[model samples]
Target: MIRKTSLIAVGVVAALGISLWGGSAMAQGDSYTIKFGNVISAGDTQNQGYALFADLVKERSDGRIKVQVYPDSQLGGEREMIEATQFGDIEMTAPSVGVLANFDKSLEVFDFPFIFEDAETAYKVLDSELGDEMLAGLQNSGLIALGWGENGFRNLAMVKGTVKTPDEMKGIKLRTMQVPMHIAYWRSIGAAPTPMPFPEVFTSLQQGVVDGVENPYELLYSAKFTEPAHYLTETRHIYDPEVILISKDFFEGLSAEDQKIIQGAADEMVAKIRSLKATISDEIRAKIVAAGGTVTDLTDAERQQWIDSAIPFYKENASKVDTEKLKAILEAAGNTTYLEAIQ
Candidate 1:
């Protein structure tokens, strides 16, 4: 009788252990939602690129996690969404690094005018150890930096006229990304650059609030800025990186496995987004011309003039922010550029 009773107790304990184990597993597999927002249209490159991340996360987690994309400022502007993500109101957001500098001043290094001579050079810089270090800096500021994406190179599109020289931009009221570096560059070149959110730019331009706007050709065309600012100048000035960011609060709550999935997907999406951006510029410029936009390709001399003009900007801003780090980034660019890379 004692032997039989002991066996029964063991069976009961085993069943209880299985039930508890199943319950813990189920709790971990419980469904969750991530709100992903951005400041671009649904079909734009950045949005399409972000879809890769969302898809990967869901696939890797087998639907335990879902990311709902809110494009066209359905949530809010870049800065607003970033703050929301910081506070855990939103799960993820991608914004031009230009605007992100406001949250972490260290990012301002990317804002230096005429910094990247070409997309290839920009790519090298972004994929380097220094770039990785810079991306990691966001964690200290309450955000998780997933990987680098593209904003492409910024160009000038104006309502008043085509800008072949900095003198042409003088006294022209222009709209700029709510990025301090962009505003400072425009101001240095003698244009009245107003900082505004992406959503407000279209209406603001229509109302004559600003005479011109600056962005990559893909953006200027897709955002339909080419509709109002019909003249597109191929300045290729600042090649800005876009950042895939998530709320540290939300990220902390996630299982380590999910975190790995999210970041891995982001890495893949970065490559996809940048590749698409590389080929889209020419195609989009054609679309702009077809849509009654006047396109101006700058001469080598004119481009050099723009480069030389930025020296003053570099001098003034480097000391104002993280000068040592900024100098390190600039040195990396100078040393690793294709010309120097070949030499």
Candidate 2:
């Protein structure tokens, strides 16, 4: 009788233990939603990569995590969205390194004009230990950076005439992002740099609020900035890289498994964006010309002239920011001339 009672007690305890374990598992299966905002248009390659990230996260999480993307400055411009992300009002944002440098001064290295000659060289610096350190440093600012995303090289799009040589940039009222380094560089070349928000760029161009704007070909074409700014120049002055950022509080609160899912998805998303960007500049250049826009290619001499224009700006400002980080990027990019000049 005693033996039978002990067996019965053990069976009841085992059944209750299983029931409690099942309940705990159910409790762990909570769902989360992410709001991702950017200035990229809906069908652009950046948005395409963002959409892929959303899909990958949801599928991998078995629909436990959902990401809603707001593009075309729907959630406001890059600065506003970055603020939103920091405050945890929004979950994510991808802002250009120039704009982001406003929050973290270490990122100002990329703001220097012509630091990178091509995307491959830029990628070499960005994917290195130095880049990871920079991204990791964002945690102190209440944000977590996933990885670097591309904005490609910035070129000139003018309202009337094409600017090939530095001399031609004189007195040209140009629109630039609210980045001090950019404004300083353009001003050094004698251009009047007007800092404005991205949303106002089109109307600013149309109403002559600004004489011209600079960006990658895809952005100029997709945003229809080329409609008013008909003269396109392959200045390729700045290699812009955007950071994939999430709210530190929001990210830290997620389960470890969920965090892994998000990080993996972001990695893939960046890769997709880069792959799409490889031939996009050329493809969009053709589209712009077909749409009755004038595209200009600088001669080798003209290009050398443009490269040389940044030297004075570098000599003046190199010691102002993180000189070692700047040196690392310049050295990695094979811009030995710039590295030596800054020294």
Q: How do all models score by TM-score?
A: 0.88, 0.92
Where does candidate 1 have its weakest 10-residue lDDT segment?
Answer: 18-27
Query: Which structure among the candidates has the greatest TM-score?
Result: 2
lDDT of 1 at 209: 96
Please give, for residues 29-49, the per-residue lDDT of candidate 1 as tens digits. Answer: 557888999988888888888
Error of 1 at 252 (Å): 2.0
What are the runs in model 1 whose C-alpha is more than 4 Å off? 1-27, 335-343
Q: What RMSD does each model have against the real structure?
A: 9.9, 9.9
**Candidate 2: which pairs clash?**
none
